[model samples]
Target: MPLIVLCGLPGSGKSRRAEELREALSAESGGERRVFLVAEVAAGEGGGGGRAALRAEAERLLSRRDVVIVDAGNELKSFRYELYCLSKHTGTPHCLLLCPGGAPRPDRPPLEAPDSRNRWDWPLFTAPEDPSEPLPLPEIRAALFERRPPPPNQSTRSQPLQAAGFLHQLDRLTQDMVAALMAAQRNGVGPGQVIPLAVEGLGQEPPGLLLSRAVSLAELSRLRRQFLSYAKMHPGEGEENLPQLGSMFVQYLNSNLL
Candidate 1:
């Protein structure tokens, strides 16, 4: 599903373009695609409506698996941003269509133009003034359908670390923790002892969990290797899920220690 947002001043022919796009998209897909049109949030006094209400309506429509065309004067950049966020959150494709046909009122805020510099405003389109110009079907199709991957965000790009890097770190981190545990064992720790977990860059020890009575240097090495193998094979070992590697290893060791 893709959300096509129409933004411009009132009487800017946004409604016309929205309907035309709906028709063209439907006919082009041989009615296979469920095309929808969400008119302005409200035809209230002076054509004013709360952005919250509009966003809520758009979000509800976008949650469904339908190609939605928001027919409204999305004059504010913030309003468009909301639409963009909704699409991203729903994992749906989206683009902005600027219908530049109406005059701005001095009584209201001026329209903040869509800038290509903004990622959310990309794949932007401008409606032809003539109203008879053909739809940019090729461009629209490529933008809405070609990009199958979800858009990246702050959380996704929080770290440059990828899966391969995470796996490498996983191996190194486990090796270091295991070494620390083995060194603790050499200090004459007995059965039912709690291991003092320490590693490079750690200001404090990890959880002081009970160690197994059967724990030996050789046994710890074997268990560490086994855990490394398991971690590498685990599907959920993604970079973002590895915030507490030391703690995770400590938990793993304690679980097996019992």
Candidate 2:
């Protein structure tokens, strides 16, 4: 499954755009998939903590399905990156659907003071301000909400091994597969082409009949290595990279797992 994170500031129409995306995806896919719209309010007792809480909630929600749309005011680069990482760590494809608004300060009101007593949620402290622009609220909102076909090379359905329990399953499965591949390699098989043999033993069939697609043994090995590398290199990065890496791993598994 792939996760789409809608990023914008308050009054950026993220909610409306998210709904439109959900409807379009469902209609195109025969209305068989589940799309989650996770929303959050930043006005609670804990101001900036709401963002962290939203990230946690998004992570937990990801375990439930393949297509999740996070509706939030993601104005910070760090936050967007975190969403990407979460998708990668969970083995789900992740994309940033950004809504660039023209408001001087999309996240905050133009006339508001830093210490203003407005009870509404304040925009991110780091949001950029551009004074020369006229807000493109309608244009951006229309573009964001309009229904469109899936991007080139994107899968129509969620990939397998993306569930909450996938990590444990993959850990055990990868150990066995590696062991089998190593055994084969020891018997004179090339190390550069070991994933096909491993794929033969995966219990679950690859999603969208990916296994049936034409693929070379060398390509399979490369993909396998990519997956391993993503898992190993991800922890060193910030939380934002997790979803991106997780999604990439899931795509690899979905395309190679037999």
Give the TM-score comparing model 1 with the true structure, all chains together. 0.56
For each candidate in turn, give its C-alpha RMSD to the true structure in angstroms: 17.7, 18.0
Best by lDDT: 1
Writing each residue's lDDT as its tens digit, candidate 2 over 109-209 gives: 13222211211111112122343333333343343334232233213234343432344444444445445544555565542343343243243442111
lDDT of each: 0.68, 0.47
The lDDT of model 1 is: 0.68
Error of 1 at 167 (Å): 27
Q: What lDDT is reached at residue 105 by model 2?
A: 56
In angstroms, what RMSD does candidate 2 have relative to the true structure?
A: 18.0
Question: Which candidate comes out best when scored by TM-score?
Answer: 1
